[model samples]
Target chain A: MSQPGQGLSVGLFATCINDVMFPDTPKHVAELLTRLGCSLTSSPAQTCCGQMFTNTGYFREGEATVEAYVEAFADCDYVVAPSASCIGSVRHQHQMLAAHRPALARKVDRLIKRSLDLTEFLTDILEVEDVGASFPHTVTYHTGCHSLRVARIGDRPQRLLRAVRGLRLVDLADSDICCGFGGTFCLKNPDVSIAMATNKAKAVADTKAEYLAAVDNACLMNIGGILHRIKAPVTPIHVASILVQQEP
Target chain B: MSQLTTLPRDTDGRLTPAPPPGELIDMPRFPINARHELANTDQRNNLQAATATIRAKRALRVSEVPQWEDLRQAAKTIKDQVDRHLDSYLLQAEQSLTKAGAIVHWARDATEANQIVVDLVKATGAPEVVKVKSMVTQETELNEALEQAGIAAWETDLAELIVQLGHDRPSHVLVPAIHKNRSQIKDIFLTEMGQYGTPAPADLTDDPSALTSAARTHLRNKFMRSTVGISGGNFLVADTGTLVVVESEGNGRMCLTLPQTLISVVGIEKIVPRFEDLEVFMRLLPRSSTGERMNPYTSMWTGVTPGDGPQNVHVVLVDNGRTSVLADPIGRQTLRCIRCSACMNTCPVYTLVGGHAYGSVYPGPIGICLSPLMRGLDSPIDQSLPYACTLCGACPDVCPVKIDFPEVIIHLRHEVAEHKIRDTKPHLETTAIAAAGWFFAKGRRFTVMTWLSGLVGRVFKAKKQFGAHMPWPARLWTSARDLPIPAAESFREWWRRNHERP
Candidate 1:
């Protein structure tokens, strides 16, 4: 049987955070999807999803960015992103931005249906659990709030990690709680954000896993900062980077 | 120069002074209050243990019922119906209550509600009252209002008793003293209980049974002696003109029955059109709240009994900012809340900083929506309240009535932004967001910004030295945690060299 991704063109929505801060995550996402037999496409025209603006309550500005996103991937077969949060905003908030106009709402609805978070596309549309990759390390997954609750992506990332040739997936304590990146919330309420991140980092350290893998790089960045700050033995790694590993 | 000279007491020997008048809101901005809360390590430890245990209990109980989701849907539907036809239902309720030989009063705001209750208690010629745990009363500052009129209101519920005795604000809806551990409660009781009413044993320990025994002894006298009882209803059954008060303790039953004159101050939004609608809430509230199959005491009375219970029954339908919440299309669903702290127990933010951080009686996710909607976004705290959550989407998932917390929170945020924009001067946060939105509107501008960051990255790498803190805003991030240096190679730069747009 042919792979589910064999004849599809996938638009890689390298979210702004990944584009500027952690390029490896989206680059790896592109790499993984291409190797899985999907044709990767992109528009350098794409930037932020305006989640920061939308989440911060600046709806008019967020709508401006939302229009740009629509124009960027308007022709793609499917819009997939390494960041679950931006995908969540696209699916959840884009309609509200377009709600004043019925024609635009219908167009945005079409885009929402075609969009998928990385783990979702892998298990849902592509139907492949094991991607024949190997990563010989004990890793735990931090379920990003957007990944777990917003997108409701469930255990697809964990399933993908479990299927890896040499990966041992450990359980994270209170893994469902937010890592506290929260877009602008990290800065707006740094005290609470750092407190939560510290707790999450401590939990990650207690697992004794070599790596903490999460779907969102923003979460990894926040937790990674705390992990690095506290000098914890564990490293924060994205699921894309781990899955893209060809050698243990 | 005696401490006793400073303290005032009512004729019945209950504490006469009322607590702060503000309800359902904290005073300062969220960051400031959250920092204060986060510093108290003991409170943090207590919160973590308490919320975790409650979350586990709720999850286990919720798992037992396969129809839990169905129950949530039914509850949501029933609440939605009440919100849509609230005026008609309120009228129907008044008719039913009057037919059942109960007096009905309407309160347009918290002050009006407080005045009605005070006047009603004064009419009974009562010096004090035993109160069933009521959040609406807290919202109206009713106890304080009563105290202002020289009438003492004695809290009958265990947690409420703890709060009242200690002169502490309620931190959680279900468990008012949720921020306090057993040891803390022991200290509060040892120090404050004797001053208020009955005294604790000299050798009172932090053991649960010991504490309960002490509280029972302290409150039993007040419960029996008080001629008036005050309560806030959980559900106001419109068709039968019934009011419900659910609690784990039997104090609600005692207070609802022992007093001759009973007064219930209910939010207009608490109405459920039919008596049978309670079957849905009875199932959802207990499991979601105390994590029990059913509460130990569920005191529900339709108007009154001829001679049994309190023959003089009064219901004050208070609309303190509730109409404001009802008017919003996006946020009206928040009124569906059943005051079950399921959202609180499961909320990660609430778990960390506890309810005190929210600075409101109704904390966690529900307050984030309801407080802003009811109070408006004009206040600094209310503006900051919407951003308090990490938007983790946990609260909505666990809400018994399926209130979409994140959606409402985001909507409130938009209102806050709009409110800020209406000010004469521009705001830094909104300006920054607008500028970022401008850059993101075009990939070229985004690329240029990334290139600037990459240039800074090169300079830092070349210098082999940079300050630990980047600058003003980034320093906020670096204060507690290390942040990544911007990548020298922008993704666009790498992608351009490697392949075409494809």
Candidate 2:
């Protein structure tokens, strides 16, 4: 693992999904970092990790998006994103996607080494599990596939959740299987996707937890969407939001 | 024999070759098939229960092997070596088998392979043959061809027998009739087994033992009388010309030993260069496939066993698009598959929709890569197979040979898109992706689009917190799960208002 630069400065990569659909997630990420005594900065030039295009098989478009991303975060000490999917893309896919461009690939490799998912940045780099947050609600965490399998950020989010004051963390069955929000896969094959989502929703409901929290909002959006559509009692919340919660 | 004359055949007494193996298109697309399958509660339940049970057993068995990972790597390395030099290995296998008194024939495709089997059967002048469960035979649609040639092929494996009697496609590699529960098996047996061979008892029940007993009684008579036995080889040892069949039931053993003449149809990729390589595969196959520490019956024969096994031994090495699969550097890795079916058993999509949706003899994660490469991906069903996965990475995780299914799926997706581009079709997805790519290529453009989408999303907001339904292309998403409405304020905009720029 790369060492954090002097004085705790980090670049915020508010992944395109969060930037557009769940903007509050990046805000909470920022707030949580601030509470952890880190200085945060955002580049207006940053957009996405190009995961959408790459995963959907548009390599040319994915390459362009990746190039833009690398250009945006090239000089940052450590780039933090609230999304494991985006961080996973940057860390795993970008180098492959940009392999044709040797210089760009090298830059992506460097950026990937420095990139961290939100909880990863907190628990690993910041060395702070508890960020002085309080959320008194029964919650269950669904570890997104990329986070668990790719980024290998096992139990980091759960560890932080466990540290939250007044929070009751419950276990979700088969929490590691995908919630079926596989970018275009959900739309391309909705029946299978819906069946998988229905299973996930049932598992979440079985937990009887008031909130279903995960690192990736895209998964939450899918699981949360189904939960809301079926009028399930549980609601989806981002881990960053939960981590940044105060007495109120 | 009465049923044979109605089917058309050539003047040479050969059934007209079926369409080239991979070219038998027009199968329903995956989503369409999955839709109907999803509605079949019984199939869904059967698949869920069977796969879950097998998956647990497999995990436990695999965990018990302390050197499981090393064994998997060894298997992968051995298979990789085999694939890398398949031509030489195949020649070596042929030479070794011939030296051991086995007649070896090379089949370039399914049609030629079926022709070889039929001609070999006709030479025996036998109207009936017992078959061991072989995926290669299924891949070639050999039974249909043999029937066309006026040969009665009795499926001897219990699950394969159930599938044959029910007139159903094999839904899984390991358990051919996994979609059929005990009751379904009893129904198939009670109704159809009599017409084929020995009839089931009038009081046959859905109990597993009863079902097996019925199958045993039905197959036993055929096994006794059949002069020819047909099978699919699981592994072909190139060094000694040994063909190995790893199976649970004793049916494979019966088909191997009972008949005077035995023919094994094997995919060329099934070759393992060295006999010692079997050690790796033996350990991996059972644990990965049926979740057994070891399959109950493992039949190995090097040519004719003289006085013990069949006096006439013939092995047909079938290509059937395998060489085409081998030509692809990335896709050829799939050739390493030992047909453990571990990937299918663990795949979430396969578990839900069952194997019929894949529209190929092979299904699930391995099928997604194999079918397209073998069939040339021109068919709509084949094209859609690659997208059937959620890319959950489970299949690769459990793959004994470590085929990296998601990577292959993604690679094939690219090929499918390229194929579309070659056809000059208007792809909505391509257009939307291009537009998104343009937006992301420039930060200003991306920020503007994000703001616009957010504004539009808020404007169309419904009473529900998330958009209950969306229009057109987006409607695909909303049909199942609600699409989360874009935030009212873009994060960049919020950042502009509150935070200092870097």
Candidate 3:
């Protein structure tokens, strides 16, 4: 597929967790966008879209956060997020939040219409087949719950990864299953949450992948934590991070 | 009643413990070998193929009905209303059933419920009982109880018979032997069926028909001989005092009709306010559960027919923690389940490992929510269930009632935590949470912590462990996952260092 060079200007919304917990994710996303020949800009005003609070039942804080996110991503060609959960919040909840706040609702709807998961934006919108990067390591992909079920993104991540020059993609068993990291769920129900992650870890290990890649970093963190604990060699890398890799 | 002669109620009554409140919480420790079994490629392949086949069939039958969604909404509404007024509905159901000449028994727990049924059976002097597939009976371990009293409980359903003979736990709710493939089933039939079953073909292959026919022949004698039938109701209509049982196979139909005496142990939550309510559930159930537009057998009986089938019908209204589940406002919706395995089948996790990994008879999205409510969140397995999901919305998407399973799971996770705090000492968890709270309380504090993390990330970067650092309980995650080591500077730090005005 030919990469669309025009109409490809993209804006990236690095989730707060990724910003604080793993800043490299957004950095890689920006790098990938640059390589795709899209004029990319990171909106600094975007601290959070209030997903964490809203999911935890703090609607009021979520509303305020949604307003902040809309203001920041207002004029973007397309607002892209690395985390499906964050994008889902903006698409589903922001619309709900906009119901009572009409002014904000109209603004969010405009942005959300053009908003997309990075994989969806890259492969579907930009039509970028391969980013021309090579990492010969065997890797498995996990479809984060939000990306696959919530965002309805299928085969996009794989399509993009398959185009990469040297990546050998081995399918993870139950790749669609959650990594048991529901944000706060990891901290709140640590043991049970870990138990679920262990299963994901085992699945990734079974694939014998050097890297476990997914769209969402929240799931990656939880699975990564479990892998670290068990000392498994599998590395949990965000899809954007992998896509932006250079020939080092 | 010719069927009455075969039931030996006295002996069955003596052996088993009755259904008890929190029976699941105190369940004997199940072996923790689910990981190894789940890794079995053969079982995984079999389960994937089987669940997918049933799901496709269910989807086909259900789509034929244009009003399926409307029926589902109606069912959800009725259930919501019943749950809101459960106490009054239970009393009304009891009064109506009793007035209609059907004896009503109230069971406080599993033991009491089991004893009540056993007492009624003992009163009838039946030595053996033909059983219908009832999740409640399975939940209460009723067959095991009956066996202790030397009253043989014969499983008549195709899947239940396999489970009983195999001496295995029911993995999936609807398809109890879902984890067992045809080869394993053929072997079970071959070995267990001695003279009781038709002689096995010496070289029976893994064809479904061969296995099914072997099972049919094995169960045929039990069906012909047993007089008393013990069953569970899918729905009990309060307005008409009718009990409904929907199944794919014709076994439930035979059990309901051929018996002289019938005892149904039903959860009080199963009550629907009016007979018309059955209209919604009948359509919602078969489609959402078995994915059938309509289940093959849907048997409804009101009280007793003096000369039709069972001369006597007794309905045991079982509480068994249901009242407690109802008492919990958020958790009550779990009782709205119609025992449809749709959610289980569509569930990615449940589909991957099958139901046995949940360590409860009720597995998948519903089980994760229901088990904790019925059993409490004390056991490791029970506590682990809610976290089993990746919070995928697949189960809720296919739910006939739109139970919002993901919402319920997050809620249950909260309950598990609260239970841990109030009931058990959460020393490590509490300490960790407190420590995390202290660190992230303010912007400056968070910034400092992030700064320290960035430094550590650099150390790991030098070692190429980027995206792979974890430090004990947290480290448990890394054994299977790689943590990213942070770059030397964060965006804010980088901005501060590079873009600082000189």
Candidate 4:
């Protein structure tokens, strides 16, 4: 739990979901870190964290992905990922998933100590708020359940958002509840999943904010999909995109 | 009676019950039941309002106590001690109860327990028996057994009376009729109370007070006339042979005291090692259950006195499925539940779907763990109960004994997966997961797979996003919510294109 010195070295651990679907999120995260004066390195050996398999009760299958993740980031000072859910798995679940492999488990423990969710890297490691970016829009932030409860990243994302030049942050009702994008849960139980997502969508719409942003794109995907289906005016944006966007 | 004539006796000359028809797992699967329960708008509204109110009240009351965490830890430690040495505690409890003049009966399962109760009622020659709110009796379906034996069992608690009269199953553990609003209760009382004993007044209204008054009047006659009573114990003190019942309504007090012959059917997990152990539970139960500093009625009794309440007392210690639950190293923590229902109040799923969807006498998070263990997870419904939760962790946060609900749920999911693996044919989910695991094990394979999937996604893109309807296995994701179209270039591809130079 040691603090990183100024100008700390960081590895951009763009998760599989972000790598395949939302490439702009990682791009924005890289720009945000560069703006905050941290050196960024990209590892070509990185892939999925096996959160999907681990969460769906496939521990053995998930262990392989944990081994890949530990190997990918073994030498980095800080491994920063845009998704709290993936970082949560790396920080909390990697040891449990890798327990059968003692040597790999030790590697996982060391990797998790250096792993940080993007917000944690910004707030805790860099000690930087007010990233000197401007975005003129009223936005509501959805705190992913893993980030809020597991990582205990309370108000760090909001504090960073408030410091943006023209970004207005509105409160979301029941902000702490899960938005129902629980890895494979959305597929396993679609009926309940949509029911929960619809409630979250309505809460977001009620805020009348032009944009809904969150640390984890997986939740945003679920909420954003429903918003698009209902033809809501609000768009889903990654918090990193807002932090790095500069007015032309 | 005609029904009793059909009863068979065992070879040892005891009543060999007919397999205790309609035992646990009679209800439909959890998902099917939840689908139906979710469609009922009235039930959803009632549950939402009730759970929200109770949750807020509980939070306020629990926060007032500075040592709440210490109390919860103490409660957990004591329960673990009791569970660890449960064999010795049971023997000590039996010895102490026998010394106090209370007859103790040991029942292996539902049939034996029902037979013991029926024989006890027949010995007293009472045509009817009054009941305090007892979860063990509900778990064993004792009331139906008694009815078949020509004995009418009257439910005295207001909520249980509603469920009994309405011919409905109990939903929530603490509040059996939590799904019913005041007007529904009024209608149930008006139509059903008369057949049971006394009729509801002609001018009865839907007001809660008026409804409770009507229940009180109807139950008074049954309480005065019945010569036998049955109950479930909250906590059984091993050293003192004392049985405690914590309740809100005065009906429990009446049922516990008025009958001449009293029978208590309690789960073996309800025992604590010492009398002082009651202090932690007494404080935890009321606050976690009714959100009250102290419930209106907490009646504790030890055996019988010559001229005092219930001269002939019997204690039936039932281990219907508790021993099996205790055997699981990871799941044994579920037995620590005191049936407070705090987890139910805070659960978003329970608030939305109500308790009947769980298909067990115990509902909510505890039910999800307890029912499967008790029933052996052989049925589809038993397997489905563990997945009913979203793994929100709200239940574990508020649980008095701090049951790690999400951990147990994941463990059960693993059990289900392992069970499926044992079958000749592998499940589609298992196959898909294994395939994904293979790809994820190596970074190069994953990168190649993502590149190909993104290429296909780009070709199939209609109107710049995937349509609402998708093909077969992926349809599970698309049937409800639209999937975001994959990026034309993955982050890895973009990184390779921009940064990598030959």
Candidate 5:
């Protein structure tokens, strides 16, 4: 493993959903970054990025959330979030919020330049293609909505996956399509949610791979839950899980 | 904040009157086949041919202009900057309209907005009104409200007339009757004309011109008779207080010109600050909507045009839930929409289910965002609208305004997930994610959880079904789909056993 001096001094933004709901993502992200010689620290105050309140039409709440986000990560060199939703929010929404809330604008301006999703940070910044991990399994990747559309993190995950030894990357058809997990949309519209999830589940099943990996865990969980319920013999793992892998 | 009105609160503390189509709608079990609409093969063929022909024509027309993308970008930027200062723009729009002899009424939701218009018509002492095709009116169900008030509201657009006469809702924006074939339209025209006034000949055949002629004849009397004209504005210029409506049919021109009193219901987002800005949008709209180089009749009226048009013009600027949408930073981009329906034609999901499945007046990719914004995320139907997409980038590709639809969708999903966590104590998703976080945090726990998952997979081995074994909430998965059982050994276990020598 490369020494910490050569590593990227990445700060994990472990967005609200991943932090409170799935903290393991950040843990894996930190481990993977370490393997790539990325020195990492957890930003404790890096609470919810306010993506939720902002997108739901709560402007004042969104502003407050943006303030809290900027305050938490203001000192970090780089804010790396596990969620494309949060990273996308910081990159896109923060600038808009800055216009309305002038006091917090500067912080947001700085945050935008440094903020990135896990895949983009690892492959692009660290220049680490394949980690020295060996797991001979055929894995298919499902691209999350925000990562692909908002952040435009194209081919970064694929590039990282290509470098993994013994890991055969089988491209899932229509992989860039959403897995139908639109957060509150699922609860409000469970029927449509299932329809979207079912279609994504079918696509994942069609790939005939042992593992289904992606940069965003939200999509994975939705697809994984459906696949798990349907008994599709595929495991859904985060891209960090594979990228951080080391030989025994 | 002082100039802008806070959305009035209801007795329940939520935004008042609730959002439209509030009732729960079950998600379709399977994909809605376009073939179901095949019974109207003539209509289907007409729609397909029309859309395709227009699409090609638009491509040709647009290619001639080297500044097309430049114009689109300028429009988007203007809209973006305006939306950022939306509160000020709305205030300015209201002030300008009020200054120009127009009364401005703020509606918090659709019901309140409809009631305001119905009351406005009643006060005018007019028993009938003529209308142009306006999405805002459709959204507020203004025509239905007028009928409930015992006032007859006439649709002037030939296609809108067909939809109204046949007791059907509009399927497409520009051509409301795009889903109805020529023969079906001829039947509607033959039957409904006499009830309204002019009748088609008994020998009239199902020809497009014959149907149009029948409609023109039937609507002529109402156009001349109605004292009040109800309309929706395509663009309400805040600078000069000019409202623009672009249409191929001359009916809109008649509605504006013939009426004594004109009232236009406009959404808050349609405001363009200046007249010159119309140059950019005017070109983009027709080319994108009808695929025409220019609409045949482009009507522009400012307040009262003396002897030229209606004597009294009242522009009702509606807030509904638009202010709420504007409040959202990520979602604010949706306001940049020009309503060209380019997204609708290119959408794979929309091409299949068409508009009705959306269960809202606004359908397609735009509908998904608009409905939920107009409504709240609380109702089953409104909530379900957002998921009615595959998140393909096709909608964004064709967008003249370049509203990133896929971005808006994921942003909406983030809202949905956050709401679920906040509103409830702990749901299945939260619990499952929480558990995953615990297990995946450490190597030992990860190994143990993987083992447990493998064991559970084994239980379904006999039946080849894992869905049957899932607990409640998670059982929503097996409701329609079946899961394949897991292998006896996991990838990790296999890797450990065989690759140890490496």
Candidate 6:
């Protein structure tokens, strides 16, 4: 397999949640991409892809966020995000935002095509699954609802995890069910949200893995919140954090 | 007649509680109702088990069909075509039904539909009527209407029977009593059966067949004695004037056949282009709904059949807010629903709280999409229905009719937000959301916002609120789970420090 000889121009979209809250997750992605021989750049003009506003019914606000995002990432070769849900919103809702505005619609079309989830970027765009990483722990993967259904990026993260030198990949039971971190849904319907997260949390514990790996940070925040609240031993880790590891 | 069975009359004038006034528009919000139902641990556990069983079975049954996607597309196309020319198809159905000795009545809404059925039953002079499990009739609250007219409507389907006897609203479409376990059902039967009809033996066990037998004994006389029967049509084949009802129990078949007079309350959207349309739906419905290869009993009746079945046949075609839904291109697709309950079975939200939380005749994804469209989002519950989802895409994947649930949900949310048509006026959250939009429109604004959040995180950390619980608004999220600590140095700051050249 011939790697891109010089380097690829890759833009990092540290999704809003990850940028402000869990900086380590996107930092791991930046480190991994840098190791894989990519010229990484972050646009200071970018905050989020407007997923929060989009999903929560604030379309006017969401559209503005999306327009700012396009302005930031329009020139990049491929824009990669560590979160599937943010990327999903960019891909789906951005189009919806531009449905009435033809000028923004064209730019959105171009930006959305190159926008990819970190896993999709690794496995499909770069054609690299094993990122030559190492993690000696039993990790169960939870496919977030957007990653599994909306983005439809299958087994890409798992394949990368499997290649990690000392990692033991265990399958989580009913891994496709949402972890109830449905952004607004968590706060809006906490009772139902808690029940759903409890169900996912049980499935996470059943694997008895040391860590739960998922593509989206929001889902981790939810399921991980439950595990933490219960004083469960499992630590929730992003797929990027696992893939960015080395023996030392 | 096979034999003269002793009809168990309500010797006392006392009747069970009437069904609610109507089922289209309901009262409580999703979160409020969800909170109440979530407290019912027993119901939650029961719903989980029942829905899990159906989900597994449905997946297996669907996998058996090699061209299941093709069947789904075919069904969508057929239904879409009907929606395109609904007026013509409905007229053709009415004409065909009339020609075939069936009196067809058009009802503008629930009141009119209920009145029509009450009058039809009154003309028959039957004190009691047997009923098939029908969602449309459930939506109209036909039983309550009949009760008001001094007619006792005995639900013959086992699940509907349980719901009726328990004096509870249905939580599921196919399995209305799914929230109750066999033991709970046994208790309901034992305590309430005597008040309605045949009393259960003092020693009725929780065994499935045993409970079933008790229900059977209770309903046998109703089927034998009732001269009037009412049903909700699953699909009204317009070209043939045929009404198709596919069911698991023989009760629906009995109700369709045994009575001297049969009145079926069908929604206008139930019309199909042709009789052959059943070929697609028949293959899809049972497999999608009950996960059966074929439903145990399928009853098809065109019209009056001399001395064989009901000599007096009446079909009430209802148009209560359906045309308005049809007018909406996005919402028009909702009328394509066959009520398979696949979306509900697959919905994670529905899995936790069951159908009662939705508070409508339709529940789960269907309820979310259809209820608001049929019954405007004027009420809190109807408005809340659209927001009661995770946008997980599970419903659309499982929906036999391919109703884009997330699309409809998002569209509905847009309606609520843009129009300011919410029950709770002047939302406090609206100010925050609008502020967020302004803050998020530019990257510099977001940087400042994150910086502010980090400052708050430091303040909260000093107060020990970060890992434990957050401030007032965040407290909603932090109550059940730990609050995520905002980063001291965000990724952008890190980039500016290292990667971004000064």
Instruction: Name the weakest run of 10 consecutive residues (lDDT summed) in model 3 chain B.
Output: B11-20
**Model 4 regions lying over 4 Å from their true place:** A1-7, B1-26
lDDT of 6 by residue, A84-191 (tens): 888988998899888899999999999999999998998887888777788999999998899878888877888888889989999888887778878888888888
The model with the greater DockQ, 1 or 6, is 6
Candidate 2: segments with Cα more than 4 A from true spot: A1-6, B1-24, B461-469
**Which 10 consecutive residues of model 1 chain B have the lowest summed lDDT?**
B1-10
What is the TM-score of chain A, computed separately for every candidate?
0.96, 0.95, 0.94, 0.95, 0.93, 0.96
List model 5 lDDT by residue over B247-348, tens digit each. 888999989888788998998899998999999998888888877888899899877666767878888778778888888876888888877887776654
Task: Report how far off residue B235 is in candidate 2 (Å).
Answer: 1.0
- Each candidate's DockQ score against the native complex? 0.79, 0.71, 0.21, 0.63, 0.07, 0.81
Measured against the true structure, the TM-scores of the candidates, in listed sequence, are 0.96, 0.95, 0.76, 0.94, 0.64, 0.96
Runs of candidate 3 exceeding 4 Å displacement? A1-13, A20-24, A28-81, A87-143, A148-214, A218-248, B1-33, B39-42, B59-67, B194-207, B423-426, B466-475, B498-502
Pairs in steric clash, model 4: none
Name every residue pair that clashes in candidate 6: none
Q: How good is the docking of model 5, by CAPRI class?
A: incorrect
Winning candidate number (TM-score): 6
What tens-digit string does per-residue lDDT give for candidate 1 at B1-502?
A: 1112123463455465345445445488888989999898888888888888888888899999999989999999999999999999999999999999899999999899998998988888787888999998888888878877877788888988888776678888888888888998999899878777778999999999999999999888788777789988999899999889888788889999988889999999999999999999999998898888888888889888987999899999999999999999999999898899898888878878887777666888998888888888777888899999989898888899999988898888898888888888989977777677778878889889999978977766654323356788878898877877777887877787688744
lDDT of 4 by residue, B255-335 (tens): 889888999999999998899999999999999998888889999999987898999999999999999999999889998
* DockQ, computed on Cα atoms, for candidate 1: 0.79
Order candidates by DockQ, high to low. Answer: 6, 1, 2, 4, 3, 5
TM-score of chain A of 6: 0.96
Which one wins on lDDT? 6
Answer with 4 or 6, whichever has the higher TM-score: 6
Interface RMSD of each: 1.2, 1.2, 5.3, 1.5, 9.4, 1.0
- Candidate 4, residue B186: Cα displacement in angstroms equals 1.7
